[model samples]
Target: MGIPGGSAPSTRLLLLPGTLGAGLIGLSLWLGLSHGTPLRCFSGVAVGLCFVSAGIAAWRLRPRSRTGPWMALLGLVVLTSHLNDGLMLPTSMSGRELITLFGTPANWLQVPVAELLFLAYPSGRLRTTAERRLVTGAFALGAVAAMVMLATKTPVPICGGWCGPSPLQLVADPQLYLRLRSVFMTGTVVLAAAALALLIRRGIRSTPRQRRLLRLITLAAGLTVLLFAATQLFIVAVYTGRTGITPTVFLFETLTSWLAAITLPLAFLAGLLRQRLAFASVGTLVGRLEHVAANTVEAALAETLRDPTLRVAFPTEQGWIDVSGHLFHPPSDGSQLLTPLGDPPVAVLVHDPSLSEDRQLLDAAATAVRLSLENARLHAQVQAQLTEVRASRQRIATAADTERQRLERDLHDGAQQRLLGIGLTLGLLRNRVRGTTGRRLVDELERELCTAIGELRDLAHGIRPAVLTDQGLAPALAGLARRSGICVHLDVQVTERLDPLVEITAYYVVSEALQNIVKHADRADACVRAVHRAGWLVVEISDEGPGGATTASSSGLSGLADRVTAVGGQLQITSPPCGGTHLRAELPCA
Candidate 1:
């Protein structure tokens, strides 16, 4: 059956030669063993081995198989043929005896068939398409020659009817037959030589080791073909009656055949060894480079992570380094913090089984990064706690101010009103009694009540502004400006209303700054401007006064700054060389 799934054309072509070679070997073995020809038996064994080798090489497609087995089989055939001739089996055996035992119809067919089959094996290994076609054409021509010779010639009986010599020998004259055989042998030799030359040229252009192996194989193939040609020439010479076959020629053929057989296998083994060595060396080098690259990357990552303000990153396609992880620094205002290893930034995010996670001397930098991050987290938490505490204190201060305002209102409405009413009643009684002493006592009482009322009003104003609750921050600031006597210029531009607490806070800030200017600045004129800009209420107060004013030197201004800071607002004081004090406060409006 054909190979399954329709084998490659090359494989199909190779199979034909292999099958024919096997059939030849089987026939040769049967004839040699049955007829008791030791020379034939040995030739059969060698041919069998060659078939096996060629079959294996065809399957493997290894370079060495081209010459190795063919040379071996050719050597065995030459030796066996010569030995058979020397032994004179045909001359010694009686016709009846040879026919009954040694000579058989099968034996007659085996010899030429084996030789033809052997010739076809090398065709499969031809290098180029041209070479392959040439070799195939030669084999076809040889087959045609054999067929024509068989058709024209009559069979000549050798040892009775059991076996015979080639019919061509009987029909054609010896000279003409020898010339035909010489042409056949020469053509085959030339084809083989051409193939060998192509292989050698290919090898020469290859790597040094491969070239050496190929050259050796080519040499073996060439020598085998040369020896075969010499044997054919010697036979042709004998047929032509020029000279008898010489022992020296036979010896040379035998030696060269053996040499070809041994060299072929050696060449193949050498090439295999060279290929394995080269690949193994390459694998070792790649492994080392990979290890070095991994180590270098790890070290770099560790170094970057160890620094507080530094971050580790990976190169992007646009040649920018993207942050992969960071240590010690707070998250940037506009920029984001690096998360845990993901994507390109951290190349080796997955944990490797070979690597240790435990803290060690070699991993000190990585360990340091972990510690610093933890410390930074704890510091942030502590700051949050302090902020909460400050907020609690401010809440308490506001509550105390509310209580003071209530107390002041109670005194003004109850005790101070009651005293004024009593003084008025006393004045009316004295007028009814018509006494100067009573009137004088009533007037003194009235005067004391007035003083008490004035002190209570001052206390209420100090506790909290009635003006801030009655109107918005702008009107209160305007009232302050009107009262300041320092030519206070008010510019309030806040349109959207704010939280009561924020409005009060802004009012207080402006009031404190104006008071500072009046007390310390000694300025002739001052400007108070409050504008809402970029989600902040920006208040700027400037006075043309003697400079050199500082928050540290003035407790009130310093306290005002602290209060503003507590609410996440900034207060700046600038006293310039021109004897002007400028105070700027920015408070978040929302």
Candidate 2:
């Protein structure tokens, strides 16, 4: 506060503004009473209180804001000048002369203070170079004009006190004083207006929290300017002998000017106090969260934290979802902060970005908001089950494959071999028999053995083909085509082997389509196509038949769809009345 790049306050202790304010008040009263000067002691205290309140808040809430002490200093300047105005004590000539110039120059100090308060406002630094330059220019013009007015007697009143002899009159000229006063007044008004405009502009552009801070100061500054303008107009009208300007109206306007001046510090203090209380009340908010409804948590958070943009979201098995159970994926934008409540983030709170740094507040609030966690835990359970379900499906597929392999092996090893041996034994016995009835019985037994062996081979192939295991998908698909009752044209472009699961799915896709076509399409010729493109193994089956086909909920096709989905793939069937039925499937390999 002492200088632009001054070190931040090291301690939260802020009795300085208070001490200075009390001293100023006591001095103002003593001077007003002892020297028979007009007393405005209460107004002085209000102005001083404005400074002290803001100063204390700024120092105590240093991490949150840095604009407080500046307010206090500006108050100090006004208080000292006010005391100087009514002090009629007999003192050193130079001291009295200094006070004479002090009034205008002191008020001039307010030009920069007002400019800075607006330029920095909630923050201590200017938002841009243009604003910094604006403050600089306003300070320069105000300083130079104050110097010019002090040095010479101008029509423009520089001192509010009665006793004054200009110390710089030997080197000063009235014409130059008048000219400088005009420039000063005009420039100060123009620059002050510009600063106010900037504050309003920034407020409009800010987020909800930032704009909240701006609103009070904007109102204060706006009223102060209006009162000043009214006072100036009334003064000009009186001095120019305008008859409509009455003393009562002039007094009213002058009093209103001070009110405007004091409003800024008061408004700022009120806002800071409210914010301080809000953060301190986090414990109370914990109880509120417990009783609050599902949709009301965000509003409660906004009220408790003084941030209206707060949002509560829960994590799902699929992704993140908001309170209404709609999917939400936060983007790379940095305007909002996301605070996670648990590992893998069961729940998340999205709020004003700067609030993220208030880790203690956020952590406590998240813990306190147990109701949201209850909902989050439910979602978490769902997510866990979804993961387990996918794993179970994979295990089920592997088990089905293993069972098919076992059955195929049993057919070959246990049943087929035994049947072949029995057939051979019957043929040898038929050659040895002399009687016609006995020989015919042996031949019939051999024929029955042959028929049983043929049936077992077909059944084994249906379970899991030996051709598929030995030759791969292309040839296996060709085998399925030959075995199908209806005419089929099989097309397979993948020369290299895919994963075991992919091959099995592709094989069965052809097998199932052919079976469906033969059974339902009534001898319609079918085209079965398998191709690997862009990290996907795609299978498509088309048939020219009277069609009204769909992936029915209870059909084998529904099970196939679930199987494809389990493997991170998809199945779709297309059929319409009089249109050919087309079944398409895609399984991801990458």
Candidate 3:
């Protein structure tokens, strides 16, 4: 059977049966005025119309299910049966005979129609072989009985003691007809009991959600069977002269049977609407999931499904784990259900077993959960890649710093010492020569050697500051400030030593910012400040230079920014349109 919220049914298809049933109801009501009391006529009409309306709705709700057609058919049969009895008012013999031929069969049709409807409650299909066989037998029996009654039965009494003879009676034995009527009535009661038993068994075996949906329809069926059996037994008692059955008892039984009939269709409709509403909540669930975070999807699903114990887990190499990567043990005691969220089962949702009955809801939730899991997995992968890239860059920067220090040491020790020795040799040659031309050449050579040595010292210091290695950040920054041609202000508030990489990154940030200020700001005095806050070393450098400095425009600042990022730090340059440039670097110190 098609589930609730299946494809939309055609309006014209539904209206066809609706129009036919309504016309039959109207015809029955018009005939009822002449044949029965106003209350009795209206009650019967109400029962038939209820069935018709509910049938149309059921048809629209689940077009694939035959339950709607059966219910609508039963209502038409009921309305036609009433019309059959009313046709006795026709005085013409031929007209009466025609009504007898068609109406006799129509009255018997009610039994099999009701039986088929009962067997097909909720889903509209005869689910088992036994149910199918029972319905088939009921139709066979009803057809045979209807044909026999048409051949042997004399006439049936309508309301107000009016009667008409059956022109097609083949047998004149009234006793045989009476006996056969008793048997047919007994068989109907038996069929009702059997149908009741099947419904009861289905209820017992159903899950919680199924039970809820079946509750109303099941109750209506039970009451219908009980009333039908009581009415049949009462009629038998009256025929056999077994007891004094008062008019009051007969009237009450008739009214109760009609009430039960009316409730049957209403109950079916109620159950169908309940199922529709349940699926509607799944739409609400999808909306909720859209805004829900990946880690909290479990809680959102549980709330929407009304299963407080719901859990979402994914299959990992280590075993089953939750969204947060905590080890999870799937329930195995049969108390809960485990629903896979993907075709190949990317994740599993462990929840109340009742939810399994509503596959539409489960499928909708699964699609959302699977998407969420995939998104979270992708996000984690991206973060992992970024972390690895940052670590690699930090390692490369550390190695390059080590090489720079080695080069500085080589220049200071090897090249500077050789040049100083040459300068001393030139000085001794100048004193020994004493001749004017020789002394002049020796002095000029010594002077050239001194200038080369001074330039070498500056080169060594620029490559890697020895002061930065020996005296830490504060003293090195102070010496840098003293060396700058422009005025400089330095402030360092760090009392504890930091990681070597953090210290080096902070030193470069200051050195680079100062160089940019001196080169680009045209002798602007700069301020450099360093403070350690909450495990982070924050360094700020500001210069009174023309603003509009961007990393994209400055290769030096761009490289400096990359260095900060490599050490898992942030670099921000704020150079406004008309004034000073502010550069800030926040590096992890711990």
Candidate 4:
């Protein structure tokens, strides 16, 4: 298979092999008919058709592949060998002369073809320099041996089968060249055997992709090798002048040769057709347009190209995006292929560069999902924008939380302490100012100072809530329940400390939900329930009052939604008309 489909030669050159095969077949059949042997005639036609069909199939499958020509050569050469075999039973003096002239020369056809089949089996070339050189030398040597046989007009001895006489001698000393025939035949057979073995070994060590291509061809080639081995054994027997191995073995070997010959070409043709199977999904893909997914084009392209690693990138305003709507980029390296979708190219598929030659499949894949791909592209753009917005909101929330914590700390350690000191000073001065006229004024001023301090402490607590930091979520939640206006039934089922952010999110969800309930639920009664279950922190704040709570524009619930979203948590409010609001929030802790 030395590059089964090589650089395509001239059109005529490509068609020549098929033409030669047809002529050879027709000639062989005519000769068989003249000889009046129906079995021989049918055998010739069948073998001829096998090789010719294989050549045509390979050529059509991959016109540029040299394997097709090699396949054709295989068929044509087999025809030569078969014709030589048939010519032994001559119908004319000319036929006898042709047998004498062409018999041994035609037999040598198998030698180089066998080695060629081994070295370049299905769709590959001779892998190693040494094997290539050996096969070339065998061909050259076989040609020289044929030249010698023709020059001396020497008749090769029958191994196990009969050979007609060669009365026409071009040279006086035919025996001189005849001695060298056995030596050349043996060398050629040995080389063929070595080449075949090496081919098998290479196949065993080849890449899985290459081996997959070998599935059919390997079986056919293996049988052909066995046939050759049997022929070699027959030659060895004849050399020693022993009656060949049992008649059953000889018969089986000969019949096996015919079977192997028939199967090999057909197997190669099958191998060639396998490449086309990659495009079989074209119809299925086109049909899938009715129900195209975001990855329908990509998935279809990947399968059709037989490249599971195939990627489909949709070009966007923000560069490129993947199916998941994540920001993506075409490969910076030249290894990737960028195929734009339409004229105003909404998307481009980044794929392996090796698949560029498979233009038909790629084009079909791109076209198949153009509509869905555009929609998916738009969806991906929206996703990317959402991703950026979410990130921005998360940053804002984090900064807000940091500021709130700073304010809480300042109130607890700085302002709260100073206020306590002023109140203490007022208490100390109260006894001194007890009898003065200014004492009444001092007492009222002290009372106002205490109220101001109380309000300031409440303001700081509202900002960050010191309890949330000093204590944990459940206790802070319990404190919130105690402080709430309405009667709150608090149920805490947390057995483990949740992630800090998750706990914070859950705290805020409950805090805001309850506050909403107090403000808008026309609060008759309220329930604050927080629990840790199944890898999530679940917080529920339900109120038994008029519900109808909509997450109104920039309202309390909307702010809570942003906070919940920032922490990858969810806030769900189930408020029926004039019934009650059941606010549920879930935060993933693990």
Candidate 5:
């Protein structure tokens, strides 16, 4: 019978290995308990169970990783090593043949497979060509040694110096077998030591986060190498007649094997559990973020992730900015990573590169805070838009001032100069004309031309005054006082030049107020006061008039108010019935 979906087939395929591993472990246990020592059997069982359980959990957590499957294979290899152990053969003929043919050689694969398992830890693949070649050579050497033992050695012990002799042993010479065993054990020791050294180097060079994850596994690998080395040395001593295999020695060997087996898988599981706990903290972060404010979201995320240097920045029309709406530039030293939070990205997370090792954790944390980030992004974008609008208004005001200055320059330099030249020509003609009537006509024409020139100069000054642009606001205010038709008392305190836009805006405030006084104040005496204080230009115009004037009532005052605001300033007017009118304008100088 088949399962329901396409995934079912793969799921079932994964289940096959789990089932086979369990059965082999069961068989190993039954054989060890019935024919060998019970403590040794339980220790071997514990080792197999640890590898199988850790492998399955790791596989489920990281489905794409090969580390899980390799670990499971290590468990199977350990379990199968003890399946054929016993001093006596099975009563059945077929069972004896099967043990000699397959089970005897399968036991030899455990050492090389275990070494390869450590070499592929965490990532599940050898990182370098040297590592790959080392593991490949170990497998090949182990296979050759297994085959040689079956062909030429007799009375061969399997299952790490317990169990029984090889039923497939062909040659009768025990000395020949000892020499072969020595070579194989020496090779095993060298390979195990190399793998252990590589693991130590990895620990020393790892980042803090990486070290935390690998600490237990590294300890297990180091201990396994020591036990294997000691076991090999003892075997060599026995073969050289320096020692004999007493019951105490046998027990020590059994204990060493069991300890090595159990320690490795338990350490691996412990490391994996630590990593799982790190991932689980993402759930806690979600709960904490339920009530977080938009501005404080960055701090909350950093605290939860345990990365104090973590920063969240949102993308705006004006470029990248932080939660507080200030411009942000990511680091250039490559110490940090940028993870975009959404499609087209609402925000970017700048964090330590170590966090990149677990992309899933980073992604989960980002997902948990995505809504807060979106809100923050929208707020930043709105602020940027307001800033842009203000800048545009200022640009328009500056352009209008520039155009007014141009018109003033054209009138002064073009039409007024031509009219003066005409007057000079008329004077020359009056001298040339001897006729009395002709001279009188020439004088009359000259007088009319002078009047037109004076009118044109006044028009140019009204547009944009040359005195305000050249001399500054004090001279400009003096000019305004003299030009006014009503009695004016002007008090000028601004000595230094201000921004051109500010000066122009201030001049208009006084000019427009004086016009209102002339039209509505019944010729009341006006006081125009200008002062500079605290990076601002303050200009006040007041008149003792029977007044009820305001910016809303007068079109000129309305326009003047707008002009002040364009330069990021304010205009206020206060007028009461039969009382004095006070107009104040505050313009920023900076």
Candidate 6:
């Protein structure tokens, strides 16, 4: 039972029975017709027995079926017909006597009843019990009708001779006799034709193996109908006084009947062989589908296991191809399996062995899994790089802060203290000199020394504000606002102490913003506010200005933004329509 087109060992064995049956039919037909010795009758009987034997063997070999009994019945009928003809025909009559005997109702009935038995051969493999009973009943009815017609008949022309008394003449009712004959002949032809047509139509729509079985059954049925029809037509021609039973008609009827009788058993054998082949084909196809499905499952499993983000889906409940892998699952026995990919846990379903074979699909799935793993690895590397960059920026900010503090100390201890000492010496010199010229010179020198001390203090404050250390960010910003000669409001909402570096960064952002406002805002008042929210210190400095402030043109503000960002803070400047500018900074408090 291989696939119809596959090269399999069982196909060879399947062809053997049909071949042998055909050969046996051909050999038997040649021996029975070509030879004319007394042994010819024995040979015909032997050939008929062979046909019966083959049919019986075919029936027995098939599954327990109604077809088996039907075939067995057909074989028995053929054997009895041959045996009866052999024993009675030649022994009872010479050539002229045989021609005369053929006119008898019994002879006509025997031939038709035997022909009707051929119908059972093809349907012998797997018919239901009901169908078998119906067929048997039909055969019994046909046999009874033939017997009844034989029992009551009047003289009727048959092939230029007379069959007397013919059943129609003896019935004494011409209409009833015509009706019965017409009905019986028409029904048999119609039923046989319909059965053959249905078998052919079914074969055309079936798989190759089924087509073969149907072909055997249909061929058998067709031969039986052809032989029966020829016999009926000859009877009609002879009875209507249209033609004689010439040698040609006799030869044709004998040859056709013998061909049909021999082929019937072969047809049964062919049908049985076809059934075995069909079963084998189905098994093979099932195995192939299972193999394909297993491969798909393995591939999907490997991919999902390797990468959490990757998924696979099946489009049909059972088929060879998968339509979408991004979202699909295997069908569940009692639970719902079909769901979107984003659903929680994103379960991976196990494949059924019946649906597919698991081993063949693993390599491609493994490759996909590897690729998903690589993608995940690359993402982790990117995050690590970002963390490293952030740490580097923090280190740079710390170094910058240390350098600024050192410079502020150098200016305050070295430059500012020296300038103050020089101013004190100049003041003493002014006191010592009494003359107007000396006193004026000393006072001018003291005034110049005091101006130098003030400039140095301003420079030290710019490097690292003294007020930021002494009074915190809010007052330093407010003092700078006052120095700028702008009306400023300070709102300090944060009460918790922050990291020193964070405070410095916030103060610088405010100072730079206010300086920009005073130099370029061309407006009246400004407000500064600081608040702590969600572990961050937020500083907002707004001003009533001309309101076209831009970070791109303000280098000081841009530099302050960089410094704020270096300490892990953000700066935003919004200058809206009308006269207003807003600068906000958010810094981590921890």
Work out the TM-score per prediction. Answer: 0.38, 0.55, 0.54, 0.66, 0.56, 0.39
Pairing residues by index, what is the TM-score of model 2? 0.55
Error of 2 at 38 (Å): 2.1
Number of the top-ranking candidate, with lDDT as the measure: 5
lDDT of 6 by residue, 1-590 (tens): 21121122243443444354444345435433543234444554554555455544543454333343343344344433433233323322234233223323333343333333443333333233533443555556566556555444433323122222332334654335434554555555554554555455555654443344446656666776676666666645544457775656545545655665566666655644544443444344434434434324334342322222222432222321232222233454522223222233122333322111112122223333333323333343444455556668878988888798889998999888888888888877877899999988887888787788888888899888987877777677667777877788888876666777888888788778777877887746889898988899999989887787777877897897887787778888888767588988889877
lDDT for model 1 comes to 0.52
**lDDT, model 3, position 175:** 61
- Clash number for every model? 0, 0, 1, 12, 0, 15
Name the candidate, 1 or 6, with the larger lDDT value. Answer: 6
Model 6 stretches with alpha carbons more than 4 Å out: 1-369, 577-579
- Candidate 3 per-residue lDDT, tens place, 1-590, comes to 44654565688878887898888777667655764455666766776777777777777766656788788777777666655653334434335566567667777787778777766766677767877887888888789888887888764332233345567788876566667777887887887788778777877876565566568767877877887788778766654557654675546555654765677777776766665665677677677768877767777777766667788777766567776655679978886888887677777889866566456667776665667767654444454456667879989988988898899999988999899888888877877997999988888888888889889988988887888877788887888888887899888998877877788788888888888888889879899999998999999999988878899999999999999998899999999977889999999976
Ranking by TM-score: 4, 5, 2, 3, 6, 1
Give the Cα error of residue 382 in candidate 3, in Å: 15
**Cα-based lDDT at residue 95, candidate 2:** 56
- Once fitted onto the true fold, the runs of candidate 1 whose alpha carbons sit more than 4 angstroms away are 1-369, 411-433
Local distance difference test, per candidate? 0.52, 0.70, 0.75, 0.69, 0.76, 0.54
The predicted structure with the larger TM-score, 2 or 4, is 4
Return the number of clashes found in candidate 5. Answer: 0
Give lDDT tens digits, candidate 2, residues 349-458.
88886465355567766777765666545654555566667768877887888788888999999999999888888878987999999988887888888889999999
lDDT of 1 by residue, 1-590 (tens): 21111122365655555565555455556545655465645643563454345444533443223443343343334333323332234433344233322222222222332333233333224444655565566556556555544433322222233223442334544345455655655565565556555555655654442344456666666676667667666755664567775776656555554554455445545544544453344344434434433223333433332212233333323232323222224344522233333233332111211112111211333333333333333444454456557667667656755676577678767876886787678677767865788777767877887787778666666556677667777887888788776788889997767755566668777778788777876746888898987789888888888877778888887987877776667899998666788888888766
Q: Cα RMSD (Å) between model 6 and the true structure?
A: 23.4
- Shift in Å, residue 45, candidate 1: 43
Model 2 lDDT-worst window of ten: 1-10
Model 3: residues >4 Å from true position, as ranges? Answer: 1-4, 35-37, 85-94, 156-160, 243-253, 287-370, 373-590
